[model samples]
Target: MSVQAPRWRAMRVSDLPAASAVAARVHPGYPEDDAVMAERLRLCPEGCLALAGPGDLPFGYAVGHPWRSGSVPDLDTLVGALPVPAGAWCIHDVALLPEARGHGAAGEVVGLMLGEAARRGLPEAVLVAVGDAAGFWQRHGFRPVPIAAPAGYGAGATVMVRSLAP
Candidate 1:
């Protein structure tokens, strides 16, 4: 039997359960309500994606939305709405199961998110790098900015930014 590798695709409402499972498994220290993710998808479907394996089951998910820069949303809380005339792309979260790691899926989704942001004419991308994820974000052209990350992001969370300008 041939095994199929996971691939990135548009996230669907049905995938929320799996996405939440992946989040719980990958980031126990940082928990987010499934409704928060659902709101993001509803608010900006273009910025929501899932890494699907066989049977189209999601093993990882990425959620982003339009928002102001230099600000980090409180973890697990719903934004209620995305900002109009949004100034930047806020990469809310990206979670991958251990089995889904080392396949470049995360990086690929990041690139895709950045592309979406650029398509929307956003000038930059921002995210809170939790735990040891700062290095990973740094490798993706996101530099740790001087902004104060929320304490709800857990210890060692760093606010990172990457300019999407050419």
Candidate 2:
């Protein structure tokens, strides 16, 4: 028997609740604000994505917006809009439910997101990898940057970046 792969799509405004649930579950002890989630989708709908399986509810989500390279946004806080001169694609969060793990869905989403970044003429892709997820991002070619992470993202949180060049 084989497992069916989950599908990925642009995140809709209505998908926030499911995305929030997955975020709260996978990122234990990390904060997630409903309004912030909505604001992210509003700020850059192209960078917001959802992953789902045989069921209608989303099993995972990815949130991001175009941003500068040197600063990491605080967790659970809302940034009303992305900066006009946004140079890097800052991935805010990417979390999946346990049941959805091992399907390699994350890599698919990251690839799509990177393409979106390139399409928008962004040269760098940045993310704050919480916990040990840095290696996962590393597998996808992200390298750690020596920038400080925001408070409450917990220890081992790293700011990583990857080039979007082909």
Candidate 3:
């Protein structure tokens, strides 16, 4: 018998609790409120995804949305609305439990997010890489941008961007 590996899928509202748990586990140092995550999922469902384990519980999740370039939303704050003339895809957060790492699920979802951004006519994707995660984002074709990240993101936070243009 063979065991099926976990995979990324479109995030459903039902998965928010698991997603929040994943975030709490993976990013305890950079906490976000439950409402902040809910708002992101509500505002841009297409930008949210979950890596489901057996029984479909989320072991990891990604939350993103459209926003202006080179900007970092304040941590734990709810974004009232996405910008009307959104210029870039904002990768709000991606978290994975230790057990969920070491597979290609993260890369898969990053590609999905970037593809969706291109399809939406956005020119670039941006994110604040927290907790020394800049290298991971770099591997996925993101490059560090020389802009100061917000204080709430803590030290070593980097602003990264990847062009969605061909």
Candidate 4:
């Protein structure tokens, strides 16, 4: 059976469980830990978005948080190593279940998140991509920052950024 296109919208508190489940399916490591996800949701509820189809079951989710000074020191180190400005909203995580995979749901989710950032007057959005997903984010206009992964997040995770127009 074919999966229907997911409807993208701002995530609500009730969406947490489904969102977390999709995240587990997609991110499976590092940030997928329960505590981390809960903390992220608690910190920036508005930055989170969910994608659901006709029946309302979540297919994917994207969450981000304000990149306040020293918010995530490891991220700070990597961004600091770059020649670009050190401040940008961090996209904490984004994930889509296998059934939702090739339907452009990811782009819609990210677009909504970046749209929110732009509306807030932020100039850019950043993320740490794992696995083979770096290319996916790259396709969405995120360019890799020339810095190695910081402590605790592990290697091979590329940090990327995409400018959001003011």
Please give the ranking of all candidate structures by TM-score, highest first, separated by commas: 1, 3, 2, 4
> Which number leads on lDDT?
1
Could you give the candidate ranking by lDDT, starting with the highest?
1, 3, 2, 4
Clashes of each: 0, 0, 0, 0
Candidate 2: list runs displaced more than 4 Å: 1-4
CA lDDT, candidate 1, residue 48: 94
lDDT of 4 by residue, 30-62 (tens): 544455555666666787777877688778877
Alpha-carbon deviation at 114 in model 1, angstroms: 0.3
Candidate 4 residue runs with Cα over 4 Å from true position = 1-4, 68-86
Clashes of 1: 0
Model 2 Cα lDDT, one tens digit per residue, 1-166: 7755788888998899889889788876787778988998988999899997775679999887899866668888877678889888988888889888898888888988898899999889998888788889999999998888887687878989998877
Give the 10-residue window scoring lowest on summed lDDT in candidate 4: 75-84
RMSD of each: 0.9, 1.7, 1.0, 5.3
Error of 1 at 150 (Å): 1.6
Q: What residue runs in model 3 are displaced by over 4 Å at the alpha carbon?
A: none
Best by TM-score: 1
Instruction: Give the range of the ten consecutive residues with the poorest summed lDDT in model 3.
Output: 70-79
Alpha-carbon error at 91 in model 3, in Å? 0.6
Give the alpha carbon lDDT tens digit for every residue of 1-166 in model 1: 9889999999999999999989998998888888999999999999999999988899899999999877868898888888888889999999988888999999999999999999999999999998888899999999998888888897788999999989
